[model samples]
Target: MYRHSATPRPYTTVVLAMSTDGKIADVARSPARFSSKSDRTHLETQIALADGVLFGASTLRAYGTTLGISNPQLLQLRQQGGVPPQPVQIVCSGSANLDPQMRFFRQQVPRWLLTTTAGATSWQKEQALGVGSFERILVADTSTGGIDWNNAFQQFFQLGVGRLAILGGGELVAALLAADLIDEFWLTVCPLILGGRTAPTPVEGEGFLSTLARSLELLSVQTIEQEVFLHYRLQRS
Candidate 1:
């Protein structure tokens, strides 16, 4: 995993639901509502275990709202652990071109924004007018105009996010995989196959060479009716 020697970052996990052919969404890039209620509950359990939930701009736009803990037992667990009822919902975007009217702004969970300088400038005017919804904004960009993930995770650690969950739209997961920042993955494979050339996968970047591909160690596998849940840990070098 990518770790800063001077700073301890959160233990990051990527949670996703994909079709049997490995498509997270259809060609239209619409919200992924194909998963069953069991999968939804599984996702909620993972979110409840995390200190923060992160998603890319595309995922946020598709859903228009972040998932909050509705299960009473999960809420009680968070209370017993001294964390808020809902984990901080974090949106990671480079441009931060988000609609303020989206239902996400009205959600009861704590919100955080992770963006670059240019993105932050777009929101600064709103914050000045006291119309911003984010409780915290972090700008962590690299010299090459990419996200400085190490720095970003260090900031997350400083903010008390010891465990981070990544809900994907593919691009974000690919970036973290490229940086070797992701630690674990929870993949739910549904029965259907969404066959489209433009469909999004769980990790979508230029992809890695066979020689440099990341390795994963299988942790567990569970089969439920029509879906299979696979848990894997990144095999760190």
Candidate 2:
């Protein structure tokens, strides 16, 4: 299935860390560590408030994530608050080459797999989403280019997906920002010195926002458990 997103207020978030030296991951290929319990708890708590969770396949592969937050108490709290028992987890695979056995697939949460033309594979999407009674939600595959972003956003809106929290290791955030689709950002800057050549910063867009020198205005800045949380908005200036 082809998909695209021409959303007006897609709440794409960029959540990650930066050390005193401005490093995000380890220097020698090690998993990034979270030092602040307060930051971790706060993030998961906010995640519980989101209608769904989105991330890229590269991020999943790097972290080996299931995409479902299964904390008993937290899930219970979310359920009591009338949120979905389990949030829908969406993965953007511009190449459509996601692993079938990744925890994201094994978990009981509903999964939406997005891909591009050069990346879209029929069998993989079907097997991954279990849309036999129907079909796996096929997002636009724009690998070779040509995506229907408007339709993608309409479908998500029809699905009652108004708010979205985009968790990242990178690429997805870059794309959303490039599209000028994100409305808000919840960024976390961690205080650690896990230097890495491969691990990247929060957003990789060139110039300012992404190659065009767009500016994001800071809305709120807070520190919890030694981590810095920065809330921002797209600058009209």
Candidate 3:
């Protein structure tokens, strides 16, 4: 909804799996496998529909995600829809100090990096090593000292991205929420408790005060085994 140009931005959906205690990770910072097989299947389905999938660099480093379409049927569907066989994988970092040898860079899908001026300058010395063709999208904002997602997303729209899926590490999700850019949420709640003060949640930016919080309208809910999947539409003011 935070459109900067006359043309519309991509439809964005934040997809995450959290524990019953609302934690996406434990205190040890390990990736949580709280979701079941069905939940992962749902995520893959969504990925097939999107033109690209975005995640924070920390999330990619922590989970080692390639952001690929594993199902042959889904890959065919993507081709039929005129999108690439695999949705592009987009990673963001404030410092851009990512390990080029990581598995994420080895994937065949298109890859992009979203970063600030400082981050791009930091990576100027390294040469691309078959890291899929990369497109660096820079967002400069003096006030925030970070990315201006509204402008970044506008650039995405101009690049022919009609829909984008966000697979998160919380900070990116929070930024999109605060900027009012995400249109839907797909959350899977598992039957486990990961109680820790330092545990990561699905959203971790400057939270809105209770009175100023955005509202959500539950669109659908499904239960598969011990996991419950919830879909919601953000209700804008």
The numbered model that scores best in lDDT is 1
Model 2 error, position 151 (Å): 4.4
lDDT for residue 78 in candidate 2, whole number 0-100: 78
lDDT of 3: 0.81
Stretches off by above 4 angstroms in model 1 are 1-6, 129-132
For each candidate in turn, the TM-score is 0.96, 0.78, 0.92
Better of 1 and 3 by lDDT: 1
lDDT of 3 by residue, 23-100 (tens): 999998797776888888999999898887889988888877565788999988877877789877888887887887
Cα deviation at 147, candidate 3, in Å, is 0.7
lDDT of 2 by residue, 105-185 (tens): 556777776555555555455566763211245666444564455555555656766667777655566666667656667
| Local lDDT at 8 for model 2 | 45
lDDT of 1 by residue, 49-120 (tens): 999999999999999998999999999999999998999999998888888888999888999999999889
User: RMSD of each candidate?
Assistant: 1.6, 4.7, 2.2
The residue pairs in collision within model 1 are none
